[model samples]
Target: MPSKIPDVVAPGTLARGEQPVIPVPGDLVIRPWVLADAGAVYKAFQDPLLQRWHARVADSESEARGWIEEWRASWADEHNAYWAIAAAGSDEVVGRIALKSVVLADGQAEVAYWTMPEARRRGVASRALTALAGWAFDEVGLHRLELTHSTANEASCRVALRNGFATEGTKRSAGPHEDGWHDMHLHARIKGDGPTALV
Candidate 1:
């Protein structure tokens, strides 16, 4: 990964506009995933809670590999930014946060995140979301970031609210989960709100 921060956009600013761009929370570094990370990400995604909540169930190792490779390609594409999260002291990936389906004209993006079961309750997801949202606003030139969680997911709701993402409403039968079609709580955050003060 490059030691220097790549040019990203700030919140409220249009990507098409002429403004100096830089990564936010500059210390919160992100890098492309190497092939070695496949195992860790696979294991993390396979966790029952994450699998059910994230709706990520691959048919086989080949499918998982394809997904990981696609994630790698997204880093270079700029339209999708998926990061393997690590704290300052550790190289082991504890979680992942992504800016997905970005629309430059709309200044909007969808955010998704998950933390390893062993790393839960340690504020890993909260920290990563804070840093990622700050970057999205400060450098990605995105004004709005949206997230969705199953209504039963209290922890994710807390993370979203703490990050200043307003709970917009529920989307009934929005999607299917391990149980069945579930209502989803939609949440959103804007650029100027700063980080969610939880932690």
Candidate 2:
């Protein structure tokens, strides 16, 4: 039988005004961000936890819109895919995820994400990742998806593990924080990992 899986996603296939909603279960939906989400995005970044992990400080709505524009440009450049994690029935930006450092030739990419304080502990990140990983593998024809987080972030560590990513090892002094550099842990899920299944 012919393969039903989609072939490699063509680079530059995702352009501005062309947001694709990755199919995944649950009440969540992933959508392309809009400038109107700037306020929510700005508020999420105000969390000290988020700011510490990302080393980003966008204290103003204007700066948040700038961040959204950068995300739009990433799609146009075909280097990254960033999505606003929102409720299925609403447009509020409760979280965000990104497939960064895309290499279509190598069929690899790095995945990263953060949830607003209200969105945590609700499986938001995990479901978002499961959806993104499935799209990256089943639809985008990616071979490998990588995730890295500071060793100190227990929440992200759990999210990675729950999303079919296996711990590879630690990158020493690879993470920066307000205090100083910290150790970083690497995890990865291959194309055949199969939907974050429980063993």
Candidate 3:
């Protein structure tokens, strides 16, 4: 027997137009990244942990600026949706998140994020993740949001689970990092997994 294809709004068609500021509880804000945020992003990239997990080092403001440009290009192409996490009522960016490798035809997207070194342990990632997941499911009409992190990265795993993403399994040696290959843990949140705030 063959599995029937899911009835979805279809991938690549969800992000149709203008992006807006998304407010989450706890005075957290998520908005599209801009060139003005380059400085903060560069500062974050200086964190050893960030560079370790992301496997990219930014030695100068110019190099970090390229990362921002790449993100902007991705947004324009609709290949990814990136955001800067900031304090509510402020333009200062403190962290980042994205609905990447989006497949609107399948009504699915992947969630990824990293908090500024100074912002860690403050629930920045969790709040941003929750707010974004809800928006993706309810407004963007996505059915599933996938999240993958290194098995050794328990903090990220906790963030995923805290946001209603259930662990499905692990992929052996799926991700390469500064140290070596890491087994990737996969988690996902489907529509209705939990409450999501549209705002």
Candidate 4:
């Protein structure tokens, strides 16, 4: 028989800012999603800057609500895990971090993230990514986690590089994003028994 998958089931909070959200720094908290977060997610995705990089476009309020509804449902499933990024003092969501599709055959998983336009350039994404990746590797026992970002997004590339995710290669026409085709830079890191730092 096989063992169970590791998760952050322990009762410690991931900190951010002065207030308690996740105890993570940089005024942000990366924690599991809840029904209360739906409104925040919808509002954050409405930002023009975020919509530019996201794969799906939400032109109407109902569409955004529907997306959040789906995300909420998916988060409840074991195969898909999601963490809402929120301001430490308030429940207002600033972004999200996720680990999905844990493939047992290859022992691999895909990582994804996003942040509000106002939250940019504050080391929020980098720190949150490192913390989340560390937790995933340590708790989930995933051998390797992969991430892909548009080549044009320099900020995202820096975050991946800072998190110790080495670039494997580029995928031509990998994503149907702006500018017809987007060159996605693939990055990955390995999990081990001992401790390590991505920064």
* Candidate ordering by lDDT (highest first): 2, 3, 1, 4
- Distance from true position, residue 141, model 2, in Å? 0.5
RMSD of each candidate relative to the true structure: 7.6, 4.7, 3.3, 6.0
TM-score of 1: 0.80
- Give each model's whole-structure lDDT: 0.73, 0.85, 0.84, 0.69
| Model 4: residues with Cα > 4 Å off, grouped in runs | 1-23, 192-199
Question: Considering summed lDDT, which 10 consecutive residues are worst modelled in model 4?
Answer: 11-20
The lDDT leader among the candidates is 2
Itemize residue pairs with steric clashes in candidate 4. 14-22, 14-23, 14-24, 15-22, 15-23, 15-24, 16-23, 16-24
Which parts of model 2 have CA positions greater than 4 angstroms off?
1-10, 13-17, 195-199
lDDT of 4 by residue, 1-199 (tens): 6647554332121111121134456666786566666566667767877877886766656666676666656643445566778777786777788777855445577888888777777777777887777666665456788889898888888888877788899988787775578888998877753213433
**Runs with alpha carbons beyond 4 Å of true place in candidate 1:** 1-29, 58-63
Per-model TM-score on C-alpha atoms: 0.80, 0.90, 0.90, 0.78
Per-candidate total of colliding backbone pairs: 8, 0, 7, 8
lDDT against true structure, model 2: 0.85
C-alpha positional error of residue 73 in candidate 2 after TM-score superposition, expressed in Å:
1.7
Candidate 3, lDDT over the whole model: 0.84
lDDT of 1 by residue, 89-154 (tens): 455767777888877656788999888899899777777787777766766567889999889999
